[model samples]
Target: MVFFKKIVLMSAVLALAGLTGCATKSDKAGYAENVVYHVNDSVVAGAAMNNIKNHLNANPQAKIVLVTHGKGIDFLLEGAMDDKGNPYNVRVQELKAKGVTFDVCNNTLVGRKIDPKTVLPEAVIVPSGVAEVAKLQSQKNFAYVKP
Candidate 1:
């Protein structure tokens, strides 16, 4: 009787462990499938862009969009370079090649007295940065991230 009870307890424990392992694997797979990143800082924009690139490489069908406004617009400004002195235009182009879309806010341009033509050619101008963020969240269901 003692040996039979020990076997039953061990079986229950093993069953629970197996279920937990399956749950963890499913979570990881879900994470890789639907991942969105939002970049709102100029200083760390490069790192965020790099992360997007890595995600795209891992999941070729991933959808990626970057929203820049306020001070973040500095990352896509014409002639703006990173800390390494590499032109931001080059980085934007590379990321574009990997299927990343960059959205620029018109409010920032007006507030800063910057001409739209002065920004990267690939950037799309939106009505307002804050509103645009809201629209993306509500309509498109894009994940908001500030790196």
Candidate 2:
């Protein structure tokens, strides 16, 4: 019985290894996919971050730009807090290191009266968030996402 169990475990391990090998092959360097994530509402902030993480994990070379306007910019504020009372800085830093960019709308800053210095370091101020998203999609052929 012990010998049979050992063989089964080894067989399972080998099967998993084979599957991993196939997965790694598909993960080989491929064409870079450009995408722009449009964030206009604060509701989807967490989900958007998760989507970005999954996107990069599946395609490490993907070019991602996160555009924020209005309430969506809350997540990129220096001392912003999520609904759960968690700060977004850690996740922002993590994604930034992985080449993700956070674009904040200048119009929002002025309209909302948020100080420029309060913006997170991972973010760059843009003339307009909506315009930036459109430019990325139209000019650069970047895929658009609203999550």
Candidate 3:
């Protein structure tokens, strides 16, 4: 009878150990990966887009938000293109489909005299791109990336 009780206790301990392992796995999987990408130059936007694509490929559940100002907003405009003449809208749409957000700085638009109508539909205009990046990092616990 004592031997049986010892065996039962051991089994209970093993079961609890298994449950603890599962809990750790669940915690890791449930954690959200939020990232903010800052872009202030159109020339680097293409490389940033590639980095974002690779990031998503590595972690499909990542939440990515891009904030653009100055020349950065050019790529998110209607009929925008890279140096090689590849349309930026297509890649923007592709990333949009994969849950990436594009934000344009309204101040840039006003300073550059760009009409809001000319901005791509996939992008939302924010009051300030720098402020948005600060908010994302400070208030929302997002990691910052400038690639």
* Residue runs of model 2 more than 4 Å from their true location after superposition: 1-29
Q: What tens-digit string does per-residue lDDT give for candidate 1 at 1-147?
A: 999999999999999999877764324532434334555669888898888877776666666778888888898888898998989888799888867888888988998899999889888888877787787788877767766
Write down the TM-score for model 3. 0.80
lDDT for 67 in candidate 1 is 82
Ranking by TM-score: 3, 2, 1
- Candidate 2 lDDT, 4-119, residue by residue in tens: 99999999999999987776534666557899999998789899999999999888989999999999998898888788889999999999999999999999999999998999
The candidate with the higher TM-score, 1 or 2, is 2
Candidate 3, 17-102: lDDT as tens digits: 89877764325543469999999999999999999999888777889999999999999998889999999999999999999999
| lDDT by candidate, in order shown | 0.79, 0.91, 0.94
Q: Rank the candidates by lDDT, best first.
A: 3, 2, 1
Cα deviation of 75, candidate 2, in Å:
0.8
lDDT of 2 at 67: 98
Where model 3 places Cα greater than 4 Å from the true spot, the runs are: 1-31
> How do the predictions measure up, each by TM-score?
0.76, 0.79, 0.80
**Residue 22 alpha-carbon offset, candidate 2, angstroms:** 18
Task: Give the local distance difference test score of model 3.
Answer: 0.94
Candidate 2 achieves a global lDDT of: 0.91
